[model samples]
Target: MKKIKIEPMELNAVKRVYLLGIGGIGMSAIARYYLHYGVPVAGYDRVSSDITQTLEAAGANIHYTDSVGAIPTAFLNREETLVIYTPAIPANHSELEYFRSNGFVLMKRAQVLGLLSSNYKTLAVAGTHGKTTTSTLLAHLLATSMGCDAFLGGISRNYSSNLILADQGKQLLVVEADEYDRSFLTLHPYLAIVTSVDADHLDIYGTYDAVLNAFQEFVSQIKPGGYLVVKQNIAFKPTVGKGVGVITYGFTPDCHYYPTNISIHDGLYRFTLVTPQGSINNLTLGVPGHYNLENAIAASAAALTLGVPTEKLAHGLESFRGVQRRFDVRYRGTKIIYIDDYAHHPSEIEALVRSVREVFPNRKITGIFQPHLYSRTRDFAGEFAAALDKLDKPIITEIYPARELPIEGVTSETIVKLMSNSNAQVVPKAELINWLKCNNVDILLTIGAGDIDRMISEIVNTLEAKENKAINE
Candidate 1:
């Protein structure tokens, strides 16, 4: 395939922009960006979601149907309109086909991001996991002190938006470098952070070694004199170019940047950040979970590297409110507590379960998990089962096939059967909410990366109603 490079200045000529999957987290950020630039924006999504509605309210035209006729006529101009589509959108999508057939300039979402990043000093966060939280926190840190533009994967609660525009005269850019579809390779970052190199997206890489190779390639793309901050004990050794620097950070003391003297007070984590420059003592995180502490360490390291003052870093970490759906606490009461998270991978589930157990040790934790992808479920069923077995009671729902067709013999039962927890059972998606209503849930956790999030409002409402009824009784 031939690559077509479009400079950032060329975007100024575009009067309108159309997106195929505009409601996606990444694609929506780009939509918001175009809208911010005063361009007329419109897009098609498979469903009308809160995100899509938000976009509509912000003046971008959106439609739920996928027909070509549904596209607004204003976006049909071939020379004046640019079409951006997510990779998840099917190749045969009617609107996508119309744009391609009509000679409109079409680009992938990653390509558009690459063009935008090239116009500034891009700081990219890439990994199999933790990239969203790390990148969002890093954006918060930089935005608070020096002002930066950010393209985040998850919506930051602090800012209430995923796209953060830079203040005038600030050339800094922070982006979440997605590993899926080898999208991160499009970015040539001035600074990069590799949080972890876990084997994932096997459908894309085919083997674990290929995944490592891709990360190594990503490291090599850093511009000369750039810095690469990586997590301690990552398997891939980066081949950094001359004048490029490497730094490691983790919870251990050996890391150049780490934390020590950890303690929790008033349900929050307080620890001293130990860095090569100096140690910041008695710092507290605004979010919960020990894994989040590690994410904070990585974000702080990146900020410090960029010459953000220690005081600003401390304030940013303490004031950060965390991202939505990462570890969102929906409800808390004496009778029942409900939490929701976007953790579909086995390792992520393990960390979430462990953190919940640490926070509420005496309570019975009931986990309701919906597996995300067929490939991922088939690839990591045993690992998923093992992690879910840690919960006091586990409810497994059918797989949510995001981009892939259903695989024979690969279902939620695959993991349910492998789990050692005798309380584990396979529940259909239709019956999951009703099943929860009938049960006595002490600590409720809804964990997955798919449509499971759509059910959170109902779960919270039901649980809240239950708590209110009990109180009145």
Candidate 2:
């Protein structure tokens, strides 16, 4: 919230861009955006991962250390360099301190996003669980039917990147509106979708009601005469400004936009998407998941509002591959199936398990879940236990602490102790693949929001080797 020497509207005045936490998903997308516009980009992160590697490949100067010397020399000139940072960066971070002392132009990632929305017709999707999938789907739908530039929170398997650049004509911007730390408040979208609002980030908001109130404020920020597309069954009912249009979508026909004649072939869905404009028959979602049917409806409504033809929407949906790590099926072996998902909250876990059960009926599901934060683990241990208990075999891993210090006695066992399912047990992330080697798994899921993703490739390889050895014997 510090006063910026150069506002995002004055981005052209800035000579270079530097990010504090360049490896983060949202931050990396912005870094890519600046790079695409021919700006010199540099940054610092605590660690390097696939995201940072990709950014480096795309002409970003990134370093893992926090030293001020780690910054590129070109970005050293405070007057010419704009520094963007994420909320995850700590107050004591040395590079952040150096930027503060040097009097550089500063902005939060969301602030720049708000500035972008001011220039284009913005379509934003906000929620606790389904925002990534919904927003990515909307971006794909718009990009294929018409054209759009998108800042996504997840890597799109179709685009293979989180940032999508719009072609010259009919530019629209699609963004995933994050609710954590009230970040989504910065956006005033022409079309906003709320997929779900659940009790999350208790570390920040402290109460479920606070989470609802923040979302309520978010919807109220939608531009007048714009559209509010929300789920019919979510707990919160939004209050929008005068002349703002409201549309509801869900599984049943009572909603404004719903699907009918749902059928599945080879794990993919074919259904009639019923919207107020008209129905798109035989629309096939490129991904498999019962939960995604609702996402499709929300995205489809937004796409239709923006003048996308029904035929183009249908074609786009059929070709749309989902975001990576959101019900991403890595491999399908004859005896073993491996999937990965970013389901950190209890509600997300429940939906994921339900969809997995429906998709691979009669297959035993063995899920490895790494809880994300200490506060969340402390606040929702029982709920998590109940949700994870739904898996035939639930393997709980060590908690991944992103920002907060650990609370005494709050560990992965915090959830396992509350579980009624005897099969549930705690394991360290380092030992997960070894555990997999010994255990029998029919359907395997690696689920979480943390570095648990780093273990995914090894897990898939282990499962594949196990299957091959079985056949050789």
Residue 321, candidate 1: Cα error in Å is: 0.4
RMSD vs true structure, all candidates:
2.7, 2.6
For residues 1-473, what per-residue lDDT tens digits would candidate 2 score against the true structure?
Answer: 11223464365568899999999999999899888878899999888899999999999999988898778898998778889999999999988888898888788999888886667778999999899999999999888878898999999999999999863477588999999989999999988999998899988998999999999999999888899999997888799999999999998878889999999988889998887766778889999888887788899988888888988988889889999999999989989999999999998999999999888899899999999999999999999999999999999999999998999999999899999999999989888889989989999999999888888789889999999999999
What are the runs in model 1 whose C-alpha is more than 4 Å off?
A: 1-9
Model 2 lowest lDDT segment of ten: 1-10
Q: What value of lDDT does candidate 2 attain over all alpha carbons?
A: 0.89
Candidate 1 lDDT tens digits, 142-191: 99998899999999999889999854456889999999999999999999
Clashes of 1: 0
Q: Which residue pairs overlap in candidate 1's backbone?
A: none
Candidate 2: give the clashing pairs: none
